[model samples]
Target: MMVRRSGRYTTWRGFKDFALGKPPDEEKEKPKPEDDLSNHDEIFLKSIVESPDFGRKSEPIESEEDLVVKPVSLDNVNIIRSLSEYRGNNIRTIEQAELAILLSRIHFKALIDAHDAIGALWLQRGSGIEEPPKQDKDTAEGAETSPEENGDMPVETVKVVGLRKVPGQPLGLTVTTDEHGQLIVARILAGSAAAKQALLSIGDVLLEVDGVQVDTEEQLKEAVSKPNDRVTLKVGPNLKEKSSQLTNKLSCYMRALFDYNPKEDTLLPCKEIGLEFKKGDILQVSDRKDPNWWQASHVENPDVVGLIPSPELEERRKAYVPPEADFVHKISICGARISKKKKKFVYESRSSVQLEGAELALYEEVARTPPFLRRVLALVGTRGVGRRTLKNRMLHEHPRRFGAVVPHTSRPPRPLEENGTSYWFVSREEMERDAHAGRFLEYGEHNGHLYGTHLDSIRAVIKEGKMCILDCAPASLKLLHNSSEFLPYVVLLAAPGIEQLRNLTFASNRNLTEEDMKQTLEESARIQRQNEKYIDLVITNHNNDTSYSRIMDALHALSTDHQWVPVSWIY
Candidate 1:
């Protein structure tokens, strides 16, 4: 069913007459990386680095400012090329987009040392050069400025010393960047002497080494890598709060890269093993690395770590299996919302739903009707237009009624937001990092912010048996227009008229002058008309009870005809 022949679904009888012999359509073409420009942001790139799904082709950020990096491998090129061809042919479908992300590579690297060999290791998130450290005032004042210096820090290089194995522990080292940077131990071999002694823990976040300052991991490594080092290490206890600082230190062995761990595993000496979790506890496994799940549950016994032999393992897993005919009876729903939080407008929603299982059995007849026979309901409006509020109202007013359109982005978060929640925020640095790494659906930029919508969200909504209610900027229309997998139900929400818009704007405390209100109205109208071709529905917020009634009526009509799933669970 996922495959297409002659650019049409062979199973759908009328599809052949409707789409057969059509002009070369890019959306119908094969999908690839470079061609998915709809989600052209940095965070999407980072996801590729962090995604467990990354295949052979992946990339990483080299520095803090490396946002918007793109992948450069041959695989990446091929994927991009496929997308380009698809776009050129005007083939629009979600299947093509899904193919692009699945084909991307996972990028990572491992740094190893002597005699500390273990399992093979792959790079994970936050695996890159730390920010350079600062130097002491006296040391900085005395040092001569470089020719290129314009009152800025001079270029400094980091060097690795021979790794030293702690008594009864794996090898590691004490490193230092400069006077301003704090000194700390780096990379303690898992189960190494230093680790067993418990005198030194990785990610101690060293504050100072023998009264010297150090900040970055590299700097900490440098300081402890000295001869006859009975150095004093002042460290802060790891805490979530900034004000919670603890310090301690003991004698330590310092070193550089260790013996190659062909099966790259084990932490570097002095490196914080897991800042977020306590000792002996398994840290959240990062998808970037191919960790042996069996090894993680290591009970100090090898036999138990091996694969479990069972007949069930070889057999197909069963679910609350539905019949093939059930998919035809599925319904789709979408939701959108906007709110003002912390002085900034925050938009959020449940996004999409796909109703299936026993639920579809009840509506099998209606679900089999022609896909286009019903009128689709699409809502398009500017930001802060209560689009999301209305979506919530429908669900409140009618339970189990709507689906959502998932939006994707590659923008990194500012110490807020969570993965798969607010937005899949990653570093712009990581975005560019993965761009070159080659992982994304469709990416683009709007209002200086980058946005992307991946296929996973689309598949998720469909899997839930609901129509997707998507919320995005106007620019995204072009990308959606070219993709067939996403059958758009667009509705343009515009202000009633200029005079009404001015009155509403002022009433809302926006304090807009008549001129400002008029200008805004003109712009909104232009955006609406520009996207007229995609508009399947329209609602006017003309500052009267009529607007709410009209909008509600349109939604009810659409639902009655099974044109769309409501924007909420109830409506």
Candidate 2:
């Protein structure tokens, strides 16, 4: 019959003392609540305590034969010894011994699982359900077979991996199953942790994740989806051949079509690869193989390399148009009104406006034309006289022979403008400093911002062997007439007589009032009468198409016909 205790039994204490090789101490018995054990626990304890040679010293098992009849107590002793040896220490007291026993249980459990898995794998290998082809030593030494030659044969390899996780981010590897039912790596994202590690490669088969064997793509994905900060994986060898293809780089220059905001795009790999460009920026395209995007750098800033939308994929911003009537027209009307007010002030003061010595010298200098190596075509006109429209037409007609001088402005760039392309965007201080240093040929203030034509900017176009064209203020002509190197062939674009002006339609959104038309006529008449000596040719703009043809004819005559030039250019 089995002995039963009525009061509480210290089975755990007894076991702990036994494992630690400590003698049990005798004391007075104390009554406590009885804790019952389940059938499994009772059986386990009985197997451990009632076994023969439970506490006997024994030799270490050296052969397989010795392990066949090993007792349960001996096996427990071996497990404890193994754990202690692994930890580089020995179990000393009851508490330490108990903790060591628990840890040893867990360690053995994991070891048993790993051993079972390895055993199953070996069994499958021996069973010959599927086998790899064997190569003869002599034949392998003579000639190695290429991967392509091994048509349908599966190559087996193994690898161990550890992947660290970032909070709420993916592993950044795309995987798919090959024809052999092996999960293979397809793509690695540009900026992911996996990409940084760079241990895995395309065409490498995935074997297991987190110790779970993965045979299919679904299994691999599910295993990787577990919630863990770090992960481990087993993978096969990479089978892809080393490529010998060369990269061909082509150089191109283009203008940015639209604005780019990198934060708005999710697919960009990193900040370095995100191409942030403003409209009208000239880009140097170095790679154009991608259908939707191209690798490029800013022309003004070559160090900035990134991906930008292809010309086919991006919509370009249209040319800028003034909110009101053309700026040239506004300038002319304002000048006329100011001159009329000044004359009225002079009459009230009972003083006649007379030219002083300095003023007479300035007028005489401007009246004399200077010699020039090349001619700058300057278009001058009153309000709504079609100066800009005619300049654009001339450019379209003669693309190779002419180029426009992009002006400098001390104003912030608009959304569709870029520095050195639409306009040379600069600060007020820089523009003022340059102006004081005589770097500008002509400078003026408009809308509370400074706008000017720099000498170097004009020469930049001239250096390209093309005639420089400008639509400028009348004051600029006076300055140009004084310089021998920059003498302009001034063309005054005049409004037609009142009858023809009434018949013509203006191409602006602002309503052309009678007062506005009247002011334009007066301004045109004043320009023709006062600047007749400086004007090379005066063309009345009645019809756009007809006027364009007449201007082209005039330009042709100027280029071919001989005219008077200053003696300085001849010398």
Candidate 3:
């Protein structure tokens, strides 16, 4: 039913028209404005737009709406028409004058708009308001308006800015009087009331707060303390100069190793704005300009900035130095007080050399990462707890998923013992040599045989794609906790109440005394206090079966829930 034609020339012409656009003759005709722009006026507007001093960019005029043409006043049009009729050639002589006329009109319109926005606030709305007498002008023409120091220096222009008070939030700034006796902003905390308003900046001079002249820092503080919902601040801001007090943002986070109560800190310049956080709370350390104090906010709420003690400040104040004999590893123990007891900590690394670290797990740098199964789950406990029973049950119940790092021993194999199954059999000489080389995490010469937990043994289980269940004493906990190579999730198996512990079969089988059980609880408390930051979880050994199930649930969570780890582990 359809007729086909070659029509190759017609198709080619159509394609050419699309690429090159319609010819001028065939293009749509747009109706011109009834009163068109004069050549001089058009050139004047274009010159103003193109001028760099005007700070405007030239854009293509696509339509009448885009151009936003405002017709000249009828009176001006009549004057121009009359001038053209009298001296047609004269119109070109003063064409440059149009730009001046256009600029004046724009300036006048801007003034009206600004007055409409803020002029009403200038009125004295309440009683007891007295206007200060005006002073003679001294600033040079086009001088910047900013906060001015009170004495000696030539006066600079001051701008009065209004700020609304936010309830239950600190003013988010600290003030101090300069040597010139003028109140100046010492710090402007990020995300605080002043920061959000953006009208105040660090180093701004405070002239008045809520209509009260603030010549000193005390006056500024008192004025800000008023219960008014809206407060007016007269400050001199220097937009041209940058203040060194402005904090630079750092992409870092710190986990609080110890509880901090700001009210107790005597050195805080402004105690009310000090940051308070409990142990293990992660903080986003936004600013670290000062070595003694840092600007930080909780990770859960980063909008409010507060001051917290710096790592250097806390390190010097809270550090507990141990004796040389027990300083086997001099690494920083975050949140833990160093115990001087030789048996509680390693005497030295296996290499016979002390580990080189001044690390006090004091504010430990942390990073959030994707869900990952930890390589090791190290169990630490007192003697009376069913810690060993719980760990063995996990291995027996899920051998494919859980594993144990076989401890190395130099003793001869007993009747039923096997080489690798029972223990990694080794010669005493080799054990001594390895222990001296720091190959063993914790080693000792017991009776005539050498026994120790080897770091390499733990690696073997992890290599097999199983989470190694490491049963080690408290002495080895520090080494494993800090080692990125092991990434152990340390859990402290605590003993239950003495009465509850006495009801256990294990306690009865050994004929443990009440005082012995009481001593175990005391030792458990001491261990927890020393390594509070390093411990990920604590489960009381009320029932062996219950503790086993609790540990299994936690192990499963390690693979499904996001975890926060030391930054050094990843980077």
Candidate 4:
């Protein structure tokens, strides 16, 4: 039978004979291009079954021998030294293993050092930057023209102002944004590296560093940390700011009443430039033209100028704080809370000047005044805090030094009582009218007799050259303490802890229960939260004598010390 093979039909009898391993026909053996039957190029046909296992059925091998004839180990692989047996005499395993890595690192560091040294040598021989094109005489003269000579319009300067960074020292300069929203060098910390830069000023406006525009501290820091640690800054003068600084000849100082970290203030125009202040931090307010943000710096370091929120801005942020509930409804006399029925507090007068200074300004303008005693010594605290006792002691022990404002009364004069001595005796109709006119500070009826402290009576004590000592309610502080008149130095007689109050032996609060002590703490906390800004000093009235002595010391210091009173008290 003929079958197709090698793209041509050929006889299949020889192929069937080759596969059967039955000896080949031997008649002829066709050779392909790859097969050579003989060196003479002639066919020498042989039996196809001559090879070993040629006819046996194909099957898997059950057993095998190793194929790798030349297997090697660490000992044999290294001819110089047997690596498997090598170990240090004293070095630990970790150190021995890392020796090569350490040497490699050393080599790398040496290479880097060599590179830097070579580069420095080459840098010394390198060409310098090309000189800038010279400006014409007219252009140079125009540059020298003053801003004022140019019709109040500031002449733009095309130059840079900066300080060099000393090696191994910080820049010691803080950044802030100006009113124009430009980044500026705000504060130069005391004893900092930059403070040595005499030419650099606090308000100098920054435009760019290392030719890269930087608007934030982060950006500036990134720009400054170039290949070379030294950086160049492009600065423009804040002409308007300079004018404002010149206009404000007097150093306007203020006492910060709140802790303000600019970083935490989300509303601050630029947090990086905002001045941080703690409670009672004396600050010199440099600029107040912006009603929201005032440029100020710590009095301790007035060289650093930074923005702080204005009083109006901070007050608006706090929103409307209604009158204190306790101060409004209840009445505390001599650091003791009395019942509403007993006190008979006038509801209409709750909104009076009692709350005038209650919500104290965040920053109070303060100035050091000549040695002078406070106009009024107003004491405040909850009931059973020994306020009345302290006031009475001050008056009793030092009669000439401390005096009380003899209140007015609508009741008829008693047999022995003299006018302006026991009480200011006034007709009932006239007293009612004066009380209605807000002349009476704490007016209310007591057993059908109208009795209350009058503004005029407090003034009378002041006119007598005596500190008018009054244990008035915390609410009355607003009406009594002010910038114009009645600059009362308020003191708070605070309640002790429950444990301290419970173990008190000197205080005569035998009637107070556990709940009463807790109530006192809560009330004291409320008053402190509401009127702490108004208070000048606080004395915990755990021991009456100790507190009394402390109060005496405070009163003595007030007169002798140069008081930092509200600047409004002066100009």
Candidate 5:
């Protein structure tokens, strides 16, 4: 049969015969040019097909009498004497049986030492200690004992606990296991049976439930899950230090982004701490140090305090978009035409003496429009689009008349930042609470921290009789436009073309990636298309000097020239 040898097929009967314990067929074993087997292959074949007698079989014995028994003789053996024995005839010695026992004990101790060394090495490699050291058979049999009998560790003190549960109501406590294999109370739900009792605390180790010893989390859960309205538990106080300090009281305001139902949530401890709010409802945050939850109350009703999800401010900001932007495409075609017709009608009506009731009301409203005392210059753009640089330049050029409002943030101040100069550093609870209370003119989250401009802070600048210039997110335009307190002049700071942007000397300093440039371009296009109506001016920021000059000219016009105002503001 043909066999594969090296890279070629060859009809070699020698290997087949050799494999079957037969001698090689010399004629068939002859090498051919087509058979590319190397010297190594020949040597391998010869080694595998060895002679039948290579590993010789022993011959069977004829009978049991053929075996001979031999004994070692002590007559020819020389016994060596110890040097100490020759010097002193009174040397203390142990009995033979006792000596054998001592030797066995020493051997066992050596084995245990070697085992411990191996276990230590394994632990150092992060595998963790596997099993306890094996005790000697005799010692192991009598080693079983209680903790008190060992007297090496403190004995745990167990306390009996009884909690009542209303039918179909939750027990309001969650359980988990610690490293020591103790069942611990993880969370006590508010307003539930466990929370009301005040006996169960977070980190309490559960020893028994309903008279049955419970060591595992599953056992404790099963014990508490019984149909009965009453449950009993035996627990021990946690010896470890508390993980978080309860002394700090953080305060803030927040708007609910979603609805929460305490009864439906298994993680909630009690109804008292269960916060439920509608989509737009603002909440007053009292504490936010908890890792997963925050304590807050509704802004309208401070007494209704409860626990709510501690979501980042960015999450809430993502939920907001200008209402008009949603239907920009539908209104874009007719918007300009309708605006022109209304303007023409107003202009023609102003010249006429007699007018309709609606037209007369409009005339009166426009006539009563208050003159601008101070105008807020708001710069809007995507991230890394030089809004901050432009604002800083404007302020630097006109520091006396133009001022910037210090934004408030829920993030910690950086090493170089001051409390009121760089940012108004506040806690998440405080930021959220104030935001929901309508204290902020604009707010958004970034990098897990809440950032917003408070209305009061802006008013403080206006109160000083200085115009406030802010570079803010596009989402804040509508809020600022509607506010009469600070008549805001919205300007879209469009990003220059990618080529122009890259050529700028300051572009490299911004550390902008390809994706960032692409996003900025996309966002610029979105603002122009969707929010064109809200934009009073557009500056394609190709050159810093040119853009600054244009901004100055626009600000000058808004301040000195006759400008249109909203009818609602006049009313």
Candidate 6:
């Protein structure tokens, strides 16, 4: 028997003894180089079974390649600590958690502090920052960037009793189901040192914490709320156990886990505060290097969509993004090729207008894309590409610069939901009356419920001189394009390459298995081929950092470079 050691394989002295059970003929045959057993761990070996990167060092980029690397320093850590402290000290409500998260760079450790800070902030709610004094109406209207003084300190912890989509609330972790359909925590961020000590992993199922039995998400959250530095966890056995025939007693057992000493990576009080401040609004920002940024968010600047004002600062921020040029946009007009053939037939549009007066050019120009146009942007994806989540991320990125398209539906609104706020939950009777009166621009059945987009949704966005981004299924795209209600510019997000499509799906942590990825990729390929006939412009999303950047680039080409207006604008 041969074992891999270091970088080479060697037969051990006791191989003959270990191989005693092998047949004589099998033993006679020499093992191939590929078959040589090595000391490599199973995890490393698995990758070798495919292709290996061993001994392959990272290469230096060409000067033209323009790759910039920044050394991660201790200062980044302190900044993270300051952000965490701010969240802990100032964040006041659950409603503000998501917004704070959107506004802040706090995650991982900061998230932990935000958890505690939110509780403390809630308890001492009187410390809320006073509102900024009113300015002239014209100044307020033209305010491109919000003052940092209006910013809230990141909240420490937010325990969501239920999974309700509050208009501006952040999505906190609750003990949830795993890919195997087993009850486990999808993620946890409470500052319960005990929870961490007890080794409560992201995928660990909560049978009970501290002997406070829990079965539902709510119960798990409540169990974690106990005031202590140490806690015990009763865990349900893993999926592998269930696959075998584990007994019930074996499946459920109480295990004591303790919060070990705070790791050096423990966010400082102030670092936690930084978590809740908008990355764009951080003044005197700390410099901290933390992995939590990668932990919570699926991708860092997935599309790399925003602009950078300072060349020096932009270089620093770009370090966090994946080292890939995201979304490369080009414009074509009158059937002429432009910057890249990849963008053939694509009319790019960008909403930004550079101005010199603001303290931060990027911050001021960030909100250039108005709410209405954004609604149109939302409609660009296939179902589950996250229309709602997309809207939320956009609004979070833009703040009050944009608002959601509250559909004027016929259904009655849910409790605490307002008429012209979260949504216009209406009556079926009114819906029917609107349908008969031709008030609906687009209508459909969703989640077995009837939902319609009335003209009012578009009107609301246009009222703000913004374009509305509406989502429609592939079948409805043609109708939307032809409709008299609006003639919106269409930039089709096509998943043409199967391999690329699979990467996008898998990257999203959407429980896509290998087979599912293969199947969806094939389906996407088919759709892309079919869609090619109708698409005016196509942007194939490979789910790389380039996807969003390409989209942004395309927008620039359409809106500014080429002036290729959508039919919506002209009509």
* TM-scores, one per candidate: 0.30, 0.36, 0.68, 0.58, 0.36, 0.31
List residue ranges in candidate 1 displaced over 4 A.
1-378, 383-386, 395-399, 403-416, 429-449, 506-509, 543-545, 559-571
* Candidate 5 steric clashes: 13
Supply candidate 6's per-residue lDDT for 406: 70
Q: Which ranges in model 2 have alpha carbons more than 4 Å from their true place?
A: 1-374, 502-505, 568-571
lDDT of 3 at 63: 40
lDDT of 5 at 451: 79
Q: Which candidate achieves the best lDDT against the true structure?
A: 3
Residue 500 in model 2: lDDT: 64
How much is the lDDT of residue 225 in candidate 5?
A: 78
Q: Indicate which candidate wins on TM-score.
A: 3
lDDT of 3 by residue, 443-464 (tens): 8766778888887988899999
lDDT of 1: 0.39
Clashing pairs in 4: 176-273, 336-383
lDDT of 5 by residue, 190-308 (tens): 44567655666677777768769888767776788799878877666666765764633555445443456666656554554576766445566666655556666765677445676
lDDT of each: 0.39, 0.59, 0.68, 0.63, 0.58, 0.40
* TM-score, model 3 to reference: 0.68
Candidate 4, residues 182-243, lDDT tens digits: the string is 77766554444455544355677676786677877678877765556566666656655454
lDDT of 1 at 382: 64
Give the lDDT ranking, best first: 3, 4, 2, 5, 6, 1
Model 2, 419-538: lDDT tens per residue?
889799999999888877777766778889988888788788878887788887654565565567766778898888665666663463435778778877877766654444356678
Native-to-model Cα distance after best TM-score fit, residue 525 in candidate 6, in Å: 4.0
- Score residue 381 of candidate 1 by CA lDDT: 70
- TM-score-superior candidate, 1 or 6: 6
